[model samples]
Target: MALLVEVHVPLTPTPGLPPGEYPFPWIEQVEDFLVDLEEEGAAESCDEGTTFGDYFVFFLVGATEAGLLAASSRVAALKGVPAGSFALVTDTEAPEMGTGRRVGLPL
Candidate 1:
């Protein structure tokens, strides 16, 4: 019933913003969203993944498919979030699924 939501956020500097500005403000928004998810019993765990030079990845577990999609959409609508920002929805318990390959289309 729960799904894995993989969030990929770009860390590139936004034009017209101050130096060293965080390109994606949606990250905080997503964190807040996760809090709501927890309150609603839709989130089991959330973890910040290793950050590469240009982007960062985070994982969320125990989210309903609809909830994850809605949260991802909200993050994509936030200001200062780059176009590269996206979320991958995956069903880890689905039959015929590969070994660690549950990424869905970008959100």
Candidate 2:
């Protein structure tokens, strides 16, 4: 089966976080949320090339039969990621990601 992956690469830190530099300190909290998902076997991190823009360090999580975007979205709700800035995609249209329809955010 095609790997189910979720992208959670936000362009900026959540508004709740204090202003800081690029690769903002609050990014860690986001990763922590996803990593917790991974630890729970909800998803696994992927090393794929799907740059939304130019420079932004984020994760691409892949699950088994279903993409964990919904789970990640729920996590974002608790973690303070901006709802407007968030998005989700799957590999339904392409073997490589980034071509899926928008439903959701980064891993």
Candidate 3:
């Protein structure tokens, strides 16, 4: 199963670091976590980007439920993380279809 792991952060984040630095701590935090998880094969694919003008969204795939929970916990525990900065894990599988164009497709 695939999961979309989202990490939302401020537009201009300065977590645990001063301003004017590249690779902001918040971004580095998630990337570092993914790097470790990737070594363990807990995560295989990820797409990180910004959104809503107030957030940096991370879309991850191939993570187990427990793995995602662990990652979320880590993100939640980071120092200097803003209140609005949070993590969310969701299943990425397509929903079962009972109508529309999916009605006639083979399972």
Given candidate 2, what's the lDDT at residue 46? 54
lDDT of 1 by residue, 1-107 (tens): 55776666777656776777766555676567667767877654465554655666666676566776666555556666666766666655545222233333244
Each candidate structure's TM-score, on Cα atoms with residue i matched to residue i, is 0.59, 0.58, 0.58
The residue-level lDDT of candidate 1 at 71 comes to 62
Which is the winner by lDDT between candidate 1 and candidate 2?
Answer: 1
Error of 1 at 45 (Å): 5.4
lDDT of 2 by residue, 26-59 (tens): 4556667667777877776555424466323343
lDDT of each: 0.60, 0.51, 0.55
lDDT-superior candidate, 2 or 3: 3
Clashing pairs in 3: none
TM-score, candidate number 3: 0.58
Tens digits of lDDT, candidate 3, 48-67: 55564566665556767566
Q: In model 2, which range of ten residues has the least summed lDDT?
A: 48-57
| Candidate 3 Cα outliers beyond 4 Å, as residue runs | 15-19, 93-107
RMSD of 3: 9.6
Cα deviation in Å at residue 68, candidate 1?
Answer: 1.0
Give residue 6's error in model 3 in angstroms: 1.7
